[model samples]
Target: MRPSTDHPVDEPGWGPLARYVIAATLARTSDGGAVVAIVLMVNTSGGSGWLAGALGACITAPHLLGPFVARSLDTARDSRTVIAAASLAHGTTLAAAVLLYPHTHPAVTAVLLTISGLFGPLLTGGISSRLPAIAGPSQRRQRRAQGWDVATYGISGTVGPTLVAAVSAWASPATAALTLAAGCYIAAAVIRFLPYAPAPGKTADVPRPLRTLTGILASGPLRRTLYLTVTVAFSVAALPVTAVSSTHTLGVSAAAAGILTAAYGLGNLAGSAGVMIRPSHTEADRLTTHLAATVAATLLLITLTPSFPLAVTAYAAAGIANAYFFAATLAARNEYAPDNARGQIFVWVGALKITAGSAGTAAAGALISTSAALPLLLAVALTIASTLLSLAERRHNRRYNAPCGPASPHTQPENGRPHPTGPTDRIHDCSNRG
Candidate 1:
């Protein structure tokens, strides 16, 4: 390993954040593929649905505690240390999973999965927080980097499972391919040694970062962001449930499922492209409108026809809309939130994501077994909730912006709009001032 540098991370262009994004993408890809193989291997061995669900939860449940682990990123005086330490710790978790899972009992498997999952949020928060430090003074460049990051995530997302599936088909036990994935995590860590900055001076009391995060999440605007994201994330959870269907019951190969998953990712690319291709708008009205439309489109996902062609098509469209929704919510939060709370605000989004995944996964698992359509209906209801909150905010803004009338809480001034000064006659004697 290279000697760590104390270089300032923030710069004018792509640097460590860019590298971190790619490394994170590779790790996620390998884990996802390995998980699918593990799940299938267990099922083929005659594990019951309960066992399958347990294993699935094992894979995801540790996310419930992600918020706590993620908050540790806030404690770091140097993000580089956090990044390096957390990345290697994460790599170790994967290694344990790969080496230990095959020979372990199912109960032990669940324990191993939980232990492994603890690393996920830490890595997620560290990388996310580290990125802003890497790209300086320009939202455009940072957004583009994020887009590339997400795209790589999608690409690996598409290819990883298929690779595992292929190897397993040839090798008799796909689950063992996790050994390869474990190695990939180590590779991710090595890549970070290339170059990255140490984090800035202490911004908050290290001991209380998690508590501070809770307060930030309580803000009305942040609440709205999380609520909307939670709903959207749940809607996305349907995609996985549907893909699993294609893999298991519909006679679709794992490769086909992987491809179908990519289609949704492609849709996400379309959604993200909207921000890049179009003239950007910084206004709240435009942002809310885009978010509302995106959520509305999400409701249509449940309505996709059962056919593989149509289902994949619906999923892709959902991804496009959903991506726009996420970007708008995030941009609006960071743009409008209290400057000091910005880090906390962003951190909570990661927490909400993990929370959403946990809830959505368990719910979807139950519903998918009964009726694949069930998860879709639940998502539609969630979309309605997300949209309603968005529209409510719109109405609130309208009320807040309207000219102060008799019933308005804001007092009208001589200028005929609400002002800090009361509606008094001539506060400043302009006539004689000159």
Candidate 2:
């Protein structure tokens, strides 16, 4: 069982957590709103969901190159300062897009969005890297904080689209896009007020971000986490595009898309709350099994559902699973990543998640024209593949840990410490630090 919450860190009243939540909410609101706005803008203007998906891909495309940017930030003096700079750049680019989108071609808009995406790592991994510092020194506190962080993503996912839908009803998609830009600026300001803590350890000692990523990938726990992230990304990628397609298929108002999005977000929020309120063992195998099962079940339900309301409910159920999966992976990241390379691990993990999602979204775009249900079917297949992988991982672990057999080098406990037998010594070693 987990220890009691008597640590000073655990009791750090809501003040600091609230500050971080505000920043997270604002940043994610912009992200969430941008997806809705872009989809609405393209779909309303006689563009296929394919074009809208392309724009979405463009926004996440930068994640493919974001590790270098994240590496630079990791080596910087203050991660918060780096975040501020990235937020400014992202917001400015979005503002420019708001102004130029009307007068410019769709290609220009895509370019601006991609430019804005260059800063996505800052909004996601960069900000998340601060949790260790922000949540104080207790592992439990950090775990709880990570749960809250996931909840913020859900909250923003809800609020952002709600804002877009409400504003678009009153005005135009351009105005909704403008509101997203404004939210980014607000987030930037809020983030500035968050306490800044320098990264732990000497800047010069930190490995190159690529090296950091390679090292983390060597860790069995983290490698499993990354694999799970890839699967989650594919499932999530189908969400935004699928929501749009559902709007078309159901003959519903455009605003219904936002409501469906909100249902998923609400489910995410509830899922996060479940973790916070009722602590569990959180074993990787059990969590993986539960997550995969939920993904398969959610997708199948959505695929078979006959009506829009049923679809929304199915998505919400999936959202709960999504939120739980994220919480598990995030907690794993915090627990297993060494202090020095934590930033890089977070960066690459976030980048991988985005890249996978982008691929899924792009694939959905390509297939949506053929049949709206195709993307969901593809997601189910991917989810099953991921489940098989998880089972394989579990089997490998069981065999490797058998008393009569040679212990696997990757079989370290979650604390990231070396076992006495030395089999797990190299797992996330972090220059022999672990």
Best lDDT among the predictions, by candidate number: 2
Q: Tens-digit lDDT track for model 1 on 120-231?
A: 5554543555444454535665555445545554555666676767777777444444544564556456555535443323556443446655554444344556677777
What's the C-alpha lDDT at position 423 in model 2?
26
By TM-score, who's the top model here?
2
Candidate 1 regions with alpha-carbon error over 4 angstroms: 1-5, 9-11, 15-18, 41-49, 102-107, 172-210, 240-262, 273-279, 283-289, 301-312, 329-347, 361-374, 397-434
State every prediction's TM-score relative to the real structure.
0.75, 0.79
RMSD after Cα superposition, model 1:
8.4
Q: RMSD to native for every prediction?
A: 8.4, 6.0
- Cα-based lDDT for every prediction: 0.57, 0.73
lDDT of candidate 2 over 68-136, digit per residue (tens): 787755677666677877877887787787678668787998889998888877788778887766676
lDDT of 2 at 265: 74
